[model samples]
Target: MSPHAPVLLNEVLEALAPQAGDVIIDATFGAGGYTRAILKTGATVIALDRDPTVQPHADAVANDYPQTFRLIRTPFSGLAEAFAQSGEAKLDGVVFDIGVSSMQLDQAERGFSFMRDGPLDMRMSDEGVTAADIVNAWDHGPMAHIFKLYGDERQSGRVATAILRRRVERPFERTLDLAEVVEKALGGRRGAPIHPATRVFQALRIAVNDELGELRAGLEAAEATLAPGGRLAVVTFHSLEDRIVKAFLTERTGNAPGGSRHAPTAVETRKPSFTLTFKGAREAGEAETVGNPRARSAKLRAAVRTDAAPWGRIAA
Candidate 1:
C-alpha cells in the first residue's frame, strides 16, 4: 500500500468487514485508495468519482484489479444508478471519504487550495459553476450567507464586502487574487494558525459544488441501494460534513427525537432502515493524527442496514 493511505483505513475496513465475493462501492474514489484496499480483500469494488483528473488513478487501479474493480465517472449521488448498471442486486457495503481529497488539494492547476496560485476554478467535475462564478458573479447577500453558513467564517459580511469592492475594478480570476482580497479584508491572519482566506475559500468550494446537497442525496441513495445487513461507512473531514452524516444516521437508526419542542404532538415515527455500528462518531488516534494532518478533523461513522423499508425523502 502507498504510505499516504486513506484516512481511517483500518477502521473503515473493519466496519465493512469485506469477505471474498462481497460487492462494495467506494463512493468517493479519490486516488482509488479505498477501492484498491477493498479489492485486496477479494471483494468486487465499484468506484465512483466525478472529477476527470481521477481517471489516471482509476485506470491504474483497474489494471491491477481487472477482474474485481470498475470505475464510474459520476458523483456519489449517482451511486445507486451505478449499482443498478452493475446488475448487482445486493450491495454488500458502501464507503465514502467525503470532502475534497488530498490529490485535489495538492495539484495547483486543480484550483482547490487557497495556498496554491491558480485559477479560481474549484469545480470538482469538468462542468458546473466554478468558484470564480460564485465569487465574481454572485450578489453580496448570497455570497456572505455561504461564507457564514458553509465556512463558519465570523466576518462573512466584511469579507464579501471586500470582494464586491475589488471586483468592480477587475474581476477575480485567480486563487491568489481572491485570497489576497480576503486576507486584506480580514486584517491579514492576525498571527492565526490558518490563512485568513481559508474559510472564504472553503465556502466558495462548497457553494460551487453544492457539496451539502450532494451528501444528502448520496446518503439517501446508499440507504435505498444497500441490501439488508449490508454496511455503510463514511469519513468526513469537517464539522459541516460530519454533522450531515451524524444527523442522517441518527434519524435512520430510529434514535432521533420524534418531535421538536414546538411540535410535541406532531410526532412522526418511521421504521429504522439502519442500525448504528457504534454509539458515536470515531476520531483518528494520536498516532494517526501525528502522521497525517488531514486525519486531525476526520470522523468515521458506520451503520448496518436493516430489513425495514427506507424512509426516503422523509428522513432529514
Candidate 2:
C-alpha cells in the first residue's frame, strides 16, 4: 500500500489553531493523519472512520496519546450522535478530510484504483452496495445518470449501454474487466492522459458510498455539535464536494442570495450559524502540491461557529 499523507496539513492545522485543552474531531480519520497532527499540539481528539481497515491506525494513535484520544468506528455523518455518546457536550474544532486515501487507492484488493486489477469492491466501510453490485445489476438509465452526474462523463449514455449489454453475457467481477469495457465504450482512450475508466469508476464509488449525501448530513451534524466560536475546517478534493461545502457554509452563515422569487418563510429564515474564517477556499501551496500530487486539486474551506442555533435546532 502507498504511504498516506494528509493534504493541506498546514492549512488545516492553522485553521483549527489547537490549544492544549481543546477538544477536536478528526472527522474522516483515514490513516489517522490529521488526528496524529492534532495530538502533537497537546489537544484531545475524538476521531471517527467508517473503514474498519483504519482501526489499527486509530489504535496506534490511542496508544500514543493514551487518555487524550479516542476512536469511534462510525461515519462522520454521525458526528452529533458520536459526540453525544462520548459525553462530550461541545467541540472546539472539527476537521474533515473528504474522499479516499492513498492507502485505499494503492491497495489493489480494495479496488479503488482502476490502474490495478482487483475484485470490483470499492466500499470504504466494507458495507452497503459494492461497485460490482451496481454495475452488474443497476438499470442502464440509473447507471448512466451516476456517470453523468457524479463523474461528469459526457459518454455516459454509450458507456451505460455498453455495460448493460456486456453484463448480460457476463457480469463484471473485476476492476480491469470493467475498465476494459469502459475503455472500449469510449473508443479506447483516444489519447487522453487519464484512463478511460477513471470517471466511470469515480461515479460508481460515489454512488455506492453516497458520498455527497454523507457530506450533507455531516455538515449538518457539525453545525449541531460545534461550540460557539468553534472552528470547522473541511478539505475537499473536487468541484462537486467543494460546491456543497461552499453552499452549506454560505446558507448557514446567512450569506445566501436573497430570493424575491423563492424566499423561504420569514420564520424559516436561517439564523447565521457560522462566520467564514477566510475570504474563500484556499488551494495547496506550490511546495505542498509538488511533493504530494493529491494536494493538487484539494481545496480548504473553514468557518467559525456563531452563538446562533443550528439550522435544525431553530424553531420554524
Candidate 3:
C-alpha cells in the first residue's frame, strides 16, 4: 500500500499554528499523517475517521504517546457531539482533509479508482450502502440527476440510461463492469488524459457516501466546536467541495450577501464568527504537486474563530 501523504502539509500546519499543550482535532485521520505531525508539538489530538480501519493506526500512536491521542471511529460530521460527549467543550484547532485518501484509491479492494478493477464497493465506512447498491437499485431519474449535479457531467441522461439498461441484464457487481458501461455510453476518447468513466465513478461514490451532505455537517460541527481564537483549516480536492467550503467560511466571517446599507435586515445582530486567515484559497506548491500528483487539484482554506454570540453557535 502506498503511504498516504497529507497534501499541503506545510501550509496546513502553518495556518493551524499548533501550539504546545493545545488540543487539536484531526477530522479526517486517513493514515494519521496530520495526527502524527500535531503530536510532535505536544498537542493532544482527537482524531476521527468514518472507516474503522484507522483504529489500529490510532492505537499505534497511543502506544507510543499514551494519552496524547484518541481515535474515534465516526464521521467528522458528528465531531461536535463527539467532542461534547468526551467533555472537550471546545478545541484549539481543527483540520479537515476532504475526499478519498490515497490509501483508499490505491487499494483495489476498496474500489474507489477507475483505473483498477474490483468489487463495486466504495463506501468510506463499510456500514453504508455500497456503490453497486446505488447503481443497481436507484431510480433512473435520480441517478441521472446525481451525475448532472454531483459529477457535473454533460451527458448524464445518456449515461444513466445505459447503466440502467445493462443492469437489467445483470446487476452491476464490479468496478470494471460499470466503467465499461460508462465508456461505451460516453464513447471512449483516444487521446484524453482523464478517463471517460471518471465523472460517473465520482458521481456514484459521492451519492453512495453522501460526501457533500457530510461536508456541510462537518463544517457546522467545526464552527460550534472551535473555541474563541481557534483555527479551522480545510483541504478540498475538487471544485464542488471547495465551493461549499468557501461559502461556509464566507457566511461565518460575515461576508455574506446584504453586508451593505441597502440590505433588508434592520439590524445585524451578531459580529463575525471568524476572520479569514488567508483571504482566498491556497493551492499546493509546485514541489508538493510534483511529489504527489493528487495534490494538483487540492486547495486549502483557513480561518480563526472570533468571539461572538448567537451566530457563534452553529444552527442544526
Backbone clash pairs in model 3 (N, Cα, C under 3 Å; residues 3+ apart or in different chains), count: 0
lDDT (Cα, tens digit) per residue for candidate 2, span 128-164: 8899999999998999999999999999999999999
Model 3 scores worst on lDDT over the 10 consecutive residues at 307-316
TM-score of 3: 0.95
Badly placed stretches (over 4 Å) of model 2 are 261-268, 313-316
Question: What lDDT does model 2 reach?
Answer: 0.89
lDDT of 1 by residue, 154-204 (tens): 999999999999999999999998999999999997799999988998988
Q: What are the RMSDs of all candidates, in order?
A: 2.1, 2.5, 2.1
Better of 1 and 3 by lDDT: 1
lDDT of 3 by residue, 1-316 (tens): 3279999998999999998889899999988899988999898898889987677777788898787888887887788877876666559999999999988888788889888989999989988789999899998899999999989999999999998999889999889889989998998867778889999899888888889888888888888778999999999999989999898887778787664566645224457788999899999888988989999999999999887742533322
Clashes of each: 0, 0, 0
The lDDT of model 1 is: 0.89
Candidate 2 C-alpha error for residue 117, in Å: 0.7
**Model 1 ranges off by over 4 Å:** 1-4, 260-268, 314-316
